[model samples]
Target: MELKGFSTKCIHGGEEGKYEFDVIPPIHLSSTYQLKYEDQDFVYSRVDNPTRRVLEDKMSVLEKGVASLAFSSGIAAISTVVLSFVKPGEEVILSEDIYGGTKTLFMEILSKRGIKYKYVDTRYADRLEDEISDDTRLVMIESPSNPMMRITDIEKVSKIAHEHGLKVAVDNTFASPYLQNPIELGADITIHSATKYLGGHSDIIAGTATFKTMEDYELVKLHRTRLGGVLSPFDSYLLLRSIKTLEVRMERHCKNAMEIAEYLSNHPKVEDVLYPFLKSFPQYDLARSQMRLGGGMISFKLYTDDQDKVDVFLNSLSIMKKAVSLGGVETLIEQPATMTHRALPDEEKKRLGITPGLIRLSVGIENVEDLISDLENALRNI
Candidate 1:
């Protein structure tokens, strides 16, 4: 009852009914729940599902927020939250370096709908004020941001946004609840692509958005229902199972990543390594101050700018798979310029530091030595 540790919370939180009939939570596969009376707890899976409810509840507690909403995909969760807060002609301020899909949503979809966005370099918290406009309704950011591994000062940015009467949303997919809680850092909402870290093994696709206040929660929840971007009961069940081991898996992931980052930094063929823990990182102090751990992602630029060298490095890898997504049990390596951020124009990609020679590595729970050897061999070929 005391809830002494993270692992304990991971396995037991929001599992109130698991004690009664099932040791493991039952997968409520039914699309609609039978109602014995006019008013019932669950009526439709689209509006609510037992499995998804459990995941939402657990994530809310983990994120230290009032409530959480589940969605069909990460982008769905993002779009719902953005659309809920932002209106036509309203402006949203976001980091220049973010997930490709998110950038597409803001630049392409939201812009087409009359919503404008201001892209700023979030590395300097002071610069945010220059970009913030009267019409800015939301301030979105990704700390330890994707592909580049840049750390933003969430607390400072949240302070700035709150002073301007703007809502702050943070993409916590990179630094999951195990490492950082953005809600506690003064963010109004925390969003996650549960497909990455929360579903740890990379088997399920899901997304979650946690809100600090009940009002914001209901607003997002209503939009989620109306948009029909709801997570399936089966995927919810998978997420629940995966979250039970999140603490353990994240520990291994962080440990392995730090080790690998150090190795890559020392490598002759490596130009620079982007990781939160490295003292050389621009925001090293802030990362240490805000996060419990540096996290599992490592991005580095090769010494050679040759595209062929990059290909050789990726092909030479024996252990790490050349894949697109990250935060899985197995290590994954990919070039963001061509793989993840391929949709962006060349100038925009370069502006975000997603160069052709840049490689992003999602370190896994695999043997650190083996991962190191694999990267070393790959670098040797370069």
Candidate 2:
């Protein structure tokens, strides 16, 4: 049955009535299935697994993609996609304000293999055309980008990339499927770090890549099989369970985040707040046009340049835990300059707005007042 509602799709998208009595899908843990016929549905765990297949199917439904593949981690999914598609000597243009790990992967590891990359401010869609060389084969973008909350015009960028015979891949992890679907907006591939919102509880480290066509899916699936970065059956089952409540979870997350963003924007100590829905945000209109909500991630800069004050404020937080990684039931706060983006060079970090005073918050589903009070107290300490 075709599902129209997002919540309904989350709960029943990949269900095929394999069990008539049981309401929940069973987790198939067997590493290998006995080969009985010439062409059997069951296969080895690395190539395919029942549990992972269901999760992949559900992800495809949510992301509005023709097919989806689950991987061991977010990096694995991204690396596989890049390696599978972009050959040696072909350049991949990426957003300047991107995830540090992704930057390291492309520049450090992939570059050693003769893969070329360019960092551009994809937020300005028109400017992207100038950077597209004959060797440019792909464009990777992270909308509402990590820490900086930069929003790119996916449809515009995808249109520009496609015209130049380059495939567009969007890192939709920050927005999640509930907030955004890159494929629906014209991207060739949509990627998610399921370790975040999709898994919901930070218990699983998994990733997913959804494709607009079956051909691309097959191509990536082949690499995933050979590389053996497939998600485990247990983690796949956990992710499937987490996704069922995604809509409800995201609603609370967005509500809490909007209130926090507003509070931060008004604070005297906050130099800037970077939530997509915040009116003061530079790309508010474009973000609203693309995303369903502001999303749970927020990045703001402290007015003070004092490193001690910044450290004091982060340490002073009682409710919002000072930690890395986002999209959990509890709020997580971190300074990207010293935390997530520390590996990046000082010049590159400053260029991308990863300032020492900049703070990134992954708002949670907690009571809004409590969260605000926590922030207020933290700001007072600063």
Best by lDDT: 2
lDDT of candidate 1 over 1-382, digit per residue (tens):
6666888878888786644768877888888877898878699989988888888988987998999999999999999999999999899998889788999998789899999998888889899888888899999999889988888899999999899999999999999999999999999999999999999897988899999999999999999989999999899989999999999999999999999889889988899999999989878999999999999999999997789989998999989999998889889999998899999998998777788999999999999999998987888777
Candidate models: Cα lDDT each: 0.91, 0.93
How does each model score on TM-score? 0.98, 0.99
Please give the TM-score that candidate 2 achieves against the real structure.
0.99
Could you tell me the TM-score of candidate 1?
Answer: 0.98
For all the candidates, what are their Cα RMSDs to the real structure? 1.1, 0.9
Q: What C-alpha lDDT, on a 0 to 100 scale, does residue 113 get in candidate 1?
A: 95
Clashes of each: 0, 0
lDDT of 2 by residue, 1-382 (tens): 6699999999999876656786877899999999999888776889989888999999999999999999999999999999999999999999998888999998789999999999999889999989999999999999989988999999999999999988999999999999999999999999989999999898999999999999999999999999889999999999999999999999999999999999999999999999999888999999999999999999999998688999999999999999899998889999998999999999988888888999999999989999999999989987
Poorest lDDT segment (10 consecutive residues) of candidate 1: 16-25
